[model samples]
Target: MTNSISITKIRQLMTMISLILLTLSITSIAVRGFNWGLDFTGGVVADIQTKPDVTQVLLKSHLDSALSQDVQVTAAGNEGNWQLRFNDTDLDLREALNRALLPIDSNFQVTNSSVIGPQVGLEMVEQGGLAILACFVLTLLYLSYRFEWRLALGSIAALVYDILIVLGLFAVTHIEFNLTVLAALLAVMGYSLNDSIIISDRIREVFRAKPDGETDSLLDKSIVSTLSRTLVTSGTTLVTVSALWLLGGSALEGFAIALCVGILSGTWSSISIGTLLPRCVGLEPNHYKPEETESLQSMP
Candidate 1:
């Protein structure tokens, strides 16, 4: 116990860190804005396999000349594989792209094409927002039912912190926000909540075992005890996600990046924000104490 680190001792510092991150994230979102993808912005995406001579710059120039509008061209996977994204989805536009590309590489072929309409894009935006809101509400209800209101609220606070940090990085880096990224956010919520629940449960158990112990001391011990498991879990996840981000190509880049950010943020918030927020909200030993003890105390 003497050797254990006192996490509670630095609660104020952790809170300050969280507030700074939150402020930076919100401010960046306000200033830079999300780089919305075709999934949310009504556009066309085409995957083409070009000849060895084809390059992103050359393909982009050809498509730009043909379409008469700006288009994004990116390397897809192995050499000569490219992806083209445009706001226009007209049939003539598609034909024109093929014609223009033929001059560069007559054998170049469109491997895949997708078009998202304005209405569909709007619907996706609304549905994605609703999905995130639903996750938050459901998480609150479950945590409250399983433990207590304070624990539930703390978990939610940590979740918000994790999300904001991830989104903030996205804003600052200008990473594309798409359906895959949104899915990663949901996964982060679940991952962070699991860590929060484990820590909260340990704290409750500690309080029950030593009812006379200082809440701060109990919290510190609980955090220290579970520190190993948290690190192991987070480490393995980071490794896997890091590998995915490094090799998964542009298709999964946003998803992998979001997951990477989410995992790091979640781990930090679960330890700092999740545990401390409960104390700030007046959580006490009596909240988890037995009925007999409570009744005995009330006998006065």
Candidate 2:
């Protein structure tokens, strides 16, 4: 029955959340300095298809020694095919690995060889970085148009916090920054926005229901009331993403893990960022509603 919300509480929560995000980002940078994967740093990758009778261990060993350079070999397609990779190709591990294979079976032709350059990868990084910024800008615009500008501003700030926190984790954990991982970040952005929007919608309902309402208290109650729904939705999403991470192989692992980070962050942001933000900024419910217009009397 308490329609009043406390603005002070909302500001406190926002301040704390902001600080937590900054700490997470700084700590992450200090720890690993962002692990740039071979794709970004420049390296060699070869897809060598061989006979079905080939064994992974035998192939790995053969390539490692014949090339005189360290290499990793794994089944490429079926049990018959193999993919070989070496870092910083100046040593020619590819030739060495191929030579090693000749002793076993020379027919293992160099089906594919791609020497990824740092410059090429750097461009990719730039493009990817731009795309992320674009998503945030668009999300901000859309939210502002649909709701109030304050909500829009708060939602974006929270999203940035979520992203920074995830990056910090990547930096701290030293996760490889590959194309797959970049894709994961984009996915998280979309997911986090969706979650925050849901929480915002609920808080709006509480606002219009009470006139002269305090936003902080209303937001808090709205958060509590929607807590069950939030958990249920997030829990289900986590379960699906968990399965992909656990069973989808390396190809999907990064994507799934990114979701795990993002979804968790999204849940937190919904309450801490989305809910508290609009209230903290004094985005009254009446601000969004169109004013009623009276019909003009016809010459009374």
Candidate 3:
């Protein structure tokens, strides 16, 4: 068998790859945009109960044909429960939905129905954008206060990297970008921030303790010291998120997907970008060295 690559080489390779992927993610978002859901575009939302045998695909296909329009279908909390979204501009949504399900389940019931106007959708879009911007601004301020500028910037870069990659996945797949998915994005920022802070803290400690050590060696040592904690945390998180994705129903599928991607990306960024960016920007042990007081300097 061939020998495995060293951790040093691996870090170098991953850093290069991360930068390239980050560029592609930005490009994809710019060019393709997102598949905005009814939450942002304004449409009818209906929760219905159908025959137990009715699947999302079957229901969607029939609705598409009967209503003569596109319909978005997702499984809700329980079997036979589904949420449907579609434009209601020129349709009697309740009547159309009831008639469409007649053949599949005569007893089918429309449990709830609501219409989201274009103006409301626009307002939600604005509010969601502002919330994310606000989060970034707050995160930067906190990180800057806690760490040196290089480390602070590194953590922010990792957050951006993780977010862009997740957004790019949604854009490329044309997944519906809804409020639930937006909530997941905010969760991702928090997770990424926590991971970055842990790794950065360890690096700072190691740097101060081994002021004479080589940068690469000190970084490797610091990361290795925290490797087990990172793996366990990430592994447990992936397990929970995997269950959520598999069993949480379609209403939460986007949310679960976002968390899964965010966890993995956050873990990788914590180890790679968080450390690499600082080193690239000339981070040195002196930055973490204790400052001398005027009295001590004068006496010395």
Candidate 4:
């Protein structure tokens, strides 16, 4: 057997961790709910350019006091630009904001402001859900045709696992779930699938080459052989995403964070759920047996 870590032996541990995370995520979502942004729950998004002296804290306090409600204020590109999000659609709120900012800088300008209606938010939610569902179904079909039903099922399960973990983390952390975050989730799914496919193909190749080899040893060796590639790919991606998270400004913050978490979870699922589930469901040498052998054996 290869010197690679025995992922199969720790299957139970992984399952337990997944269950615990799922339970915590569900509970957090049920209790605290998501810190939905203007894109989801429907509200106003404004981009403003304030005086260089204006600070995030001062802006937030002014907006809260003027609007009589909490608002999300984050630094946008450059220094004076700021992004504001809140659940208020009244036109008067705009006037109120302008008046409130007069003390800081009479010249401050509201570059843009837009409202998202509740109905529109609902439609966006539906569309996002459909997109994820479509990805899952299509992935299953492709895998089934390319490999087998067992492998397809396993790959889908891993995908779900990756998504759930990411969702759970967001819920627990109270991160704003917005359209950008949804895009991140989809991107994560694609990356996770790529890893799963690589591992699956390697396993299939090993089966075809060494039909008489022990399944456990073959699985271990296959995973070990591909470990370098997995590490390199995932490592490089992580470095880029991490940099974005740290310095990409608030607009891309959620997107970057989502990618970072998803990459980690996806990598784990590719190794654990991707390989083990198919094995548990009865993947065998015969699944890859040469067509010529089956034809000759049947003719006798």
Best by TM-score: 4
Question: All models: lDDT?
Answer: 0.85, 0.74, 0.87, 0.84
Candidate 3 lDDT, 1-300, residue by residue in tens: 111226667777888888888888888899999988888989988899988899888999889988887898988889999988987666887679777888888899889988899999999999999999999999999999998889999999999899998998888887889999999999999999999998889988988887667778888887888889989999999999999999987778899999999999999888888888888999887678666533465683
The deviation in Å at residue 258 for candidate 3 is 1.4
| Candidate 1 global TM-score | 0.87
Residue-level lDDT of model 1, residues 1-300, one tens digit each, is 444344565765787888898999999999998988888888888898888778777888888888887777878888988888888777565577767887888888788988889899889989998998999999999998988788788899999998888889899999888889989988998888888999888888998898777778888888889989998999999999999999876668989988888888887888888888888889877688888988988996
Q: What is the TM-score of each predicted model, taking all chains together?
A: 0.87, 0.83, 0.89, 0.91
Ranking 1 against 2 by lDDT, winner: 1
Q: Write the per-residue lDDT of candidate 2 for residues 1-300, one digit (tens) a residue.
A: 333334446546665866777687877787668777766777788887777777877887777776665565656666677776667667665556556887887687677888888898798888989999899889988998876788787788778877887788788777766787888888888888887787777766776676356556666676778779889999999999999999876556666877798889878776776666666677775563433311232234
Query: What are the root-mean-square deviations of the candidates from the true structure over C-alphas?
Result: 3.0, 4.2, 3.2, 2.3
Clashing residue pairs found in predicted model 4 = none
lDDT for model 4: 0.84
* Stronger candidate by TM-score (1 vs 4): 4
| Sort order, lDDT high to low | 3, 1, 4, 2
Candidate 4 TM-score, C-alpha based: 0.91
Q: Model 4 segments beyond 4 Å from truth? A: 1-7, 74-81
Q: Which of the predicted structures, 2 or 3, would earn the higher TM-score when compared with the native?
A: 3
